[model samples]
Target: MSLEDLVRGAAAEARRLAAAFPAAGRKDDLPWAVIAAFDADVRGHVERDRRIEDERDRVLIASVTLAETPAEAEAEEWDRARRHLVRAVDYLEETVLRFGIVNRLAAKRGHGAAGDPVSALRRG
Candidate 1:
């Protein structure tokens, strides 16, 4: 799948996981499963983009840590997970925007695909 689609899917899953927290309760395993799948998708994307890997890795790590850490109360844990999910969604949305901008710029420059913008410019 395209990076945009992968990111969108992950974002949707994150939102679903966030929504599940309140109804599933702390002991439920469903949210954890969703989180694991989401993390894998994010990690795979990060791995594919070495240029931004460090920054994205940090964000992913921080979000996962925050989301996974147990709180004294169930409510607090759910709240934290929801907040992290919101940030994840925001990050994914920004990524989608960046992809759109890059694709537009590539098309304008007469490139057939959004691959190595610098190289395309050098060729031109």
Candidate 2:
């Protein structure tokens, strides 16, 4: 399965099990312990996903900082600022989509795409 589907399924299962095993109730299932068959792999995915998000944030901050420098420039400077913004947006869009943040945020804002989150499973 694709990473998105895998993450989604894991999220669903975690939700389902949350009531039965509340976060506060677990003892032996410490932060270092594996809770399920796919626990380790899922943890790795989460770590990588978080790293990507962190990188995205850094890129955005850098872009904004660069953008500020051109804000007071003349016509040519405005063009430079526009270019900077475009590059920042492009990089962020790709990173956000790779992390499925766009779809997840869209769903939260009632703008979810019709595309299946598990389209790969359906294809096979």
Candidate 3:
């Protein structure tokens, strides 16, 4: 899927989880699942997608600076490699920050639930 689509999906899931942040009364595994998936998608792109090496590198660095696991560390490093592309993304009409809010909230929820930073990156 396109990066925008992925971010939107992640943002939607984050909003869903935020609606039930503590997950005290939730019955489904949607939040966890969505977070896991989102993280995995980001990780996948950083590791294999070559269409936008620069964008991928920037994202990977930002993500790694934000991760707390060996896997996450690796993924984040890949993102960092494309730091030079930051300027390009800034010029683009579609910014990655669109999903910033939701992504943060989701991270908090994942950390609280799984006690692992990387786990928060994923949907489940």
The residue-level lDDT of candidate 1 at 82 comes to 65
Which candidate gets the maximum lDDT versus the true structure? 1
Candidate 1 wrongly placed segments (more than 4 Å): 22-47, 50-77, 96-124
Tell me the tens digit of each residue's lDDT in model 2 across 1-124.
4444444454344323322322333433421121242243233333235645554454445334333443345766645544544454344334433443323433443433333332333334
* Inter-residue clash pairs, candidate 1: none
Kindly state the number of residue pairs that clash in model 1. Answer: 0
lDDT by candidate, in order shown: 0.49, 0.39, 0.36
TM-score against native, each model? 0.45, 0.34, 0.29
Identify the candidate with maximal TM-score: 1
In model 3, the runs with Cα more than 4 Å from the true position are 24-34, 47-124
Q: Model 2: which residue pairs collide?
A: none
By summed lDDT, which 10 consecutive residues of candidate 3 come out lowest? Answer: 111-120
